[model samples]
Target: MSENMEKTIGEVGRVDWSHFSLADFLELRWRLLHDWQAVLPGGEYFGQARIGDVCYDIQIEWLADDELAVTMSPFFPHDGDSAEPPYDELVSGMPYDTQHGASLISSRRSFLELTYESFIDLAEHSILETVARFPHLQSAASKQTGFWDRHDAILCKIREQDDEDR
Candidate 1:
């Protein structure tokens, strides 16, 4: 895990997006998705986790050359259908419930843009914030506990490496 953490941090640190090209952003996105999968077991780009009986799908989208979005919403398990719920429905009122056995009781989405010297700065801050808020989520009976724990541990290791470098 530490080796993967080092590799992820190294890749993030090596990103030179001063030019802010689309290709650069794509590469960063790929690396981030890869790192998330590698560090968080069973975690995928658009994976699902459960809390009690409800299940939520995690979605990642490249909104623009400089922005990325991560969303979590209630979703029915694979039932031979590949259609996603309407965007409006997902982002609507809280605890959005659907007849498809999925309910967005506590869904959330975050958008991050490249507005710093290194994209890692934003990514690191986001991870830290997520980590700090994990306890609250868990207390609220969120099923994303495992994913958040792994994600936080990896980021902490990366931050430690950064500190050692200084």
Candidate 2:
């Protein structure tokens, strides 16, 4: 996580969500997604994260003008092993079989609709909550094989380059 994000997490309640613009919210979203991708493997994006026994699938869609919908669903790992489905498959809702008779069952109550500003608030709160509840997500992710680290690292480097260019 970046220093700014850490600071934001520390002072979550004090931040004014209403003052954030769409671009600011998107930057925060990018950082949050990057951290999630770092911890979860097998997706082109940060769509899933596993904490202990339950895996969470995150989906976000732009609704209108500054409004966005975020859905987070927790499911037992597919076949009791994998925590993620492919990005394309997830977007398309493609069917695939799992092993050991396990299945994916999503609850309908895990949806939230908010403006981009409120979404940013949720993002900050979630970052703190994830760290508090699942401290090992990042450490465990370090031990797993995934492309997120490399991908995020490249993004970081590019951002650094852009900063230098400016």
Candidate 3:
């Protein structure tokens, strides 16, 4: 799909959960962690729209079942893996705690909405490489950082807000 179509799909936000569910999302996370092409091995998924770059896959690891992980991709680095540091190092490098950094990286949410929303756009923009260059981040910096110390609390608030909006 073209970038315009991708954006349209995102705007629609009409997901077919039957074909794609939370379990599938989790599995995708695991597969992409090791291989970018896990979703389309042999590049035979022609019927499925290309979501992101095939060069690299961004692995999203959720430490807890209640959290979210953000993986980026469109263009990936040529190295065996991205040069970016691990989530722990990135959190340690931050001035605040891990939770704070997680929020910052996640745009103030415990989880990010990347795969289902902008996957097609990512490929069209050819920015998957940029996404892959970043590390697979987790929400480890809970309430200690001054934002919401309780990761659960933050997640609850976000979920509530989403529900209200809906």
Candidate 4:
């Protein structure tokens, strides 16, 4: 079994989005979007460890608006030639830092990226659904959880609005 499979049982939980800046969010989002395939579809299985191992580089190009052009490659060893096919295909676009430069590739996508946004929304909804099952985590991020007081307050407000609607 791979390290990813081992680490990926049950929920991955909420990320510390506040820690990321817009640039950081974008980078993190890019990486997560890249690794989307590695993560088992709705099955929480880790296929392999990305650290110190050759893996596909998920590439993104922003043509205009928020639409991202995503591209990927097979594992290309870090020590391999830059002119190699995988590397060539992966690095073809302009880098994100440059105007019209393809977005810089990274191991982590930024908070603003769709990757994080989708993950957070899914996690929150899952938590709301299984509130009785995972009381600890939900409470920790809930209003009753003093440690996450601010987030908890927000959750409470959301719950209040939901209740009013229903």
Q: Pick the candidate with the highest TM-score.
A: 2
- 99-159: candidate 2 lDDT, tens digit per residue: 2222122121222234565655565456345434432332332232333334435656877
Candidate 2 overall lDDT versus native: 0.39
Against the true structure, what is every candidate's RMSD? 17.9, 13.8, 19.1, 19.7
For residues 22-95, write the lDDT of model 1, one tens digit per residue. 45446535555455333233223434444422234444544444344554443322222325433332221222
Ordered list by lDDT, greatest first: 2, 1, 4, 3
Query: What TM-scores do the predictions have?
Result: 0.23, 0.28, 0.22, 0.24
Model 3 regions more than 4 Å off = 1-23, 26-54, 61-68, 73-111, 114-117, 123-166
Predicted structure 4: clash tally = 18
Model 1 C-alpha lDDT versus the unseen true structure: 0.37
**Candidate 1, clashing residue pairs?**
none
Q: What lDDT does each candidate get?
A: 0.37, 0.39, 0.32, 0.33
Q: Candidate 2's error at 127, in angstroms?
A: 2.4
